[model samples]
Every structure is written in structure tokens, then in C-alpha cells.
Target chain A: MTPQAQRDILKKHGLKVTAQRLAILDYLITHETHPTAEMIHQDLPMISLATIYNTLERLVAAEIIIVIDSLSDGKRHFDYYGQPHYHIVNTQTNAIIDAENFDVAPLLAAARQASGLNITGFHIEVYGVNPEDAR
Target chain B: MTPQAQRDILKKHGLKVTAQRLAILDYLITHETHPTAEMIHQDLPMISLATIYNTLERLVAAEIIIVIDSLSDGKRHFDYYGQPHYHIVNTQTNAIIDAENFDVAPLLAAARQASGLNITGFHIEVYGVNPEDAR
Candidate 1:
């Protein structure tokens, strides 16, 4: 997106636009693969790791990005868009692929009734070894 | 269960039964809520934190206990049983409640076809504020 558009997104999320935030946001938007904080840090060596981590926290708080926790390992992946989706994680390679959107309303409703809890959001990660890797 | 039963579980998983492992397993079996390594350490003051961590690692490798990653924070909670079920996390209180079992076969199939990935296992965690706590 344009610089002005990036600023508008930051403002919309009630976040102060900064060069560091813009860089991080731009990186996330451009990268198709779900990347961890470390992966992002590697590509942008100029930005300090602390700043990357801090920026991610603010972005998540603003609901600008979502955290995808890998089940294989405890590492987290960040997504720029807020659209609802599940994940397909490669168990051996630790590759994270977005699974198609599956309606979870029925599951959520059943959980609400059974647990008597107000459901807000859900995370689903499917783990598998890639077929090529298996072969 | 019984002392012999516990030992059998360890042997079946190719884990040599040890006092520390037994203590950890016993605690997990008795406790209903998912407990983290640190939480387990707090309960078993006699055991060193490192030993607890090591034992948890071994247990996980043995497929003895499953790790439940909390979305509110990144902390992992441990459960002894491996039964297929989902978790309902109380966002406000950080309480982890087991959601009633919902069949996810269709969802898994769709994900496999779309991603061309051989799916082995999956984790689903629903986040929400408890109605009772909200009141």
C-alpha cells in the first residue's frame, strides 16, 4: 500500500504511525508466508529485535494482525490481515499454510452452551508432515 | 489408577519410570485444569524446576501429555489425557475449560484437499470471556 494508506491504517487502529511500525507493517503485508518475530528480524537487520517485538505487540493490540501459534513447536506466526481462517502446519518442516475458511459457528454455539462461556474467537491449526517430505 | 498401572504407562511409552516422572504424572492425573511446568513446580516444591521441565519434555515426547497453548498469553498448559477435544479459554480469567467434543472430519477433509497437505492432527481453541465472570 501507499505511505498515506499505511498512515491511515495506523490511525484507524488508534496507533501512532512510526517508521519502525511502517517498516514492520510493510514487511508483514508483503510476506505471504506466516513469519515469526525472529524471521522478520532477520530480514530487517536495521530494526532492533526489541522494536520488532514491541511493534508486533502494538499491532496485535490494535487488531491489525493475528498471532498463529504453531502446535509442532510453541513458536508464533503473525498475519497482517484480520480475516478469519485456520492454519495447516507442516509438522516436520514447521511450514505454516492457511487453511480455507470453515464455518465454526456450530462449534462455537455448542461450546457456548456446554461451557456457559461467551465465545469471542477461535484458533485451529492442523499438523502434518508434507507429502513430499514423507515420500 | 494403580501403582502398577502407572508403571505400565511409562513402560509402554518407552520411558523409564522415575520418581520425578511419577510425581508429575500423579499431579496431572489428579488435577483437572491444565497446569504449566511452573505451576507444577509450585505444587511440587520439593522438585527442582529444571527436573520438572525435563520430565515434561519427556512426557510430551512419549505422547503422555498434550500441551495446550493459551491464546491470552503464550504460556503452555499440560493435560495428561490425549482424548480428542477442544478447549474454551476464558479470556478474562485465563481459565481453560474443555469444550464438548465436536466432529471436525469435514473441516479436516476440506483443509487437506485445498492445501494438498496430509493432515495428521489439529488443535482448536476457542477464546471467550466467561458469562459468569462478566456478570
Candidate 2:
């Protein structure tokens, strides 16, 4: 999103418009891969680790981004776009890719039917060796 | 499983049978909920926190248990059976229950077809409020 749009988003969420916040969201907007705070800090050297985490927490609270904790690694990953989606991880490399437009309705139904539990959100992740690594 | 069966399974995994290990596995076998190392540690006070973590790692390495990294909370959860199953978390209570016999073959096939990535394994979790709490 444009700087203006990001600023508007912050305002809409009752957040302060700051350069640090803008930079963090902008990085996520440009990078397709879901990233951790360390990755964001690495990408933007000007941003400190503390700032990165604080901004991420604010964005997540505002529902602008979502935290993904399902990867093989124990680290927390952030998704800039909070829309519903799934992810697949490259086990060896720990690389993550978004699985867009994947449907989980059938799987959710199956679980609800089998367990007799009131199903809610589904967090799905697939792990495998990236084809690029095999080359 | 019976005591003999447990012992045989441990032997098959090349793990020596110990009272602490047996106690840990026994707790998991009886408790359907996916538990954290801290939970196990709390239940088995005789086992040190370090020992609990070590045993969990050993069992996970042996493929006897699987680590779940997806829940809202950051702590690591373990599934003892290591079978193909899903989990649902109670958002309010932070309670986790297994979604047994819930197949993910369809979801897996869909992800593979969409992403064109060689998917190895799928982790699925649902979050909702347990109805029992409403009572």
C-alpha cells in the first residue's frame, strides 16, 4: 500500500502514524514471504528489535496483521495481510510460502462431524523440502 | 496399552524403560488433551523440568509424539500418539482437545494442486469456545 494508505490505516485503527510503523508495514507489503521479527529487523536496519516487536504487536491488535505460530520452528511469524490463508514450509530451509485461496471448509466440516465439537478457525501448514533446494 | 505393550513399544523405539518415562507416556495415554511440557511437569513432580523436556524431545525424535506449534499461546504442545489428527483450542479457556479421525487428505490434495509445491505434512488446528463452559 502507498504511504498515504498506510497512514490512513493507522488512523483508522486509532494508531499513531510513525515512520517506524510505516516502514514495518511497507516491508511486509513488499515481501511476499511471511517473515519473523528478526527478518524484518534484518531487512530494515534502522528499526531496532524492540521497535519491530512493538509495531508488530500494535498491528496485530488492530487486526492489520496476524501472528502465525504453526511453522516447524518455534519463532513467531507475522502475516501482513490478515485475510484467511494457509502456509507451507520448507523443512530444511525453514522457508515459508503462502498457500492462497486454499479451501478448508471440507476439512472443518469433517472435524466438526467427527469430534462433535464446535469448530472454529483452522490453522493449516504443510512442511516439505523446497523444490529449489533439490535442484 | 498394557504395561508389557508399553515396554515393548519403548524397546522397539530403542528407548530404555524408566519409571519417569513410563509415567509421562501413561499420563498422555490417559489424558486425551494435547499437553505442554509444563503441564506434564506439573503432573509428574517427581520428574524434573529438565527431565521432562529431555524426555519429550526424545519421544518426539522417536516419532512417538509430535510437537504442535500453532496454538494462540506461544508455549509448545505435544501430541503423544503421533497419529494423523487435528486439534481445536478453546479460545476463552485455553483448553485444547484433539480432533481424532479427522482426515486431511482432501485438504492436502487441494494445497498441492494449488501451490505446485511438494507438500510433506499438514498441521491443522481450530480455535473456538468449548460449549461445556457455557453451561
Q: Which candidate is the best by TM-score?
A: 1
lDDT of each: 0.82, 0.78
Please give the distance, in angstroms, between residue A58's alpha carbon in candidate 2 and its true position after superposition: 2.3
Off by over 4 Å in 2: A70-73, A110-120, A130-135, B114-118, B130-135
Residue B43, candidate 2: Cα error in Å is 1.9
Model 2 Cα lDDT, one tens digit per residue, A1-135? 578997898899999999999999888877877889999999899889999999999998777887788565677888876567877777677777776666677777776666566765667787666556663
TM-scores for all predictions = 0.88, 0.82
Candidate 2 docking classification? medium
Cα error, residue A13 of model 1, in Å, equals: 1.7
What TM-score does prediction 2 earn?
0.82
Per-residue lDDT of candidate 1, residues B71-107 (tens digit): 5666778888657777888878888887556888977
Docking quality band of candidate 1, CAPRI definitions: medium
Contacts from the true interface found in each model, as a fraction, amount to 0.81, 0.68
Q: Candidate 2 lDDT, tens digit per residue, B62-129?
A: 77887877555778888876467777766677776776666677677777776666777767777665
Q: Give the DockQ (C-alpha) for candidate 1.
A: 0.72
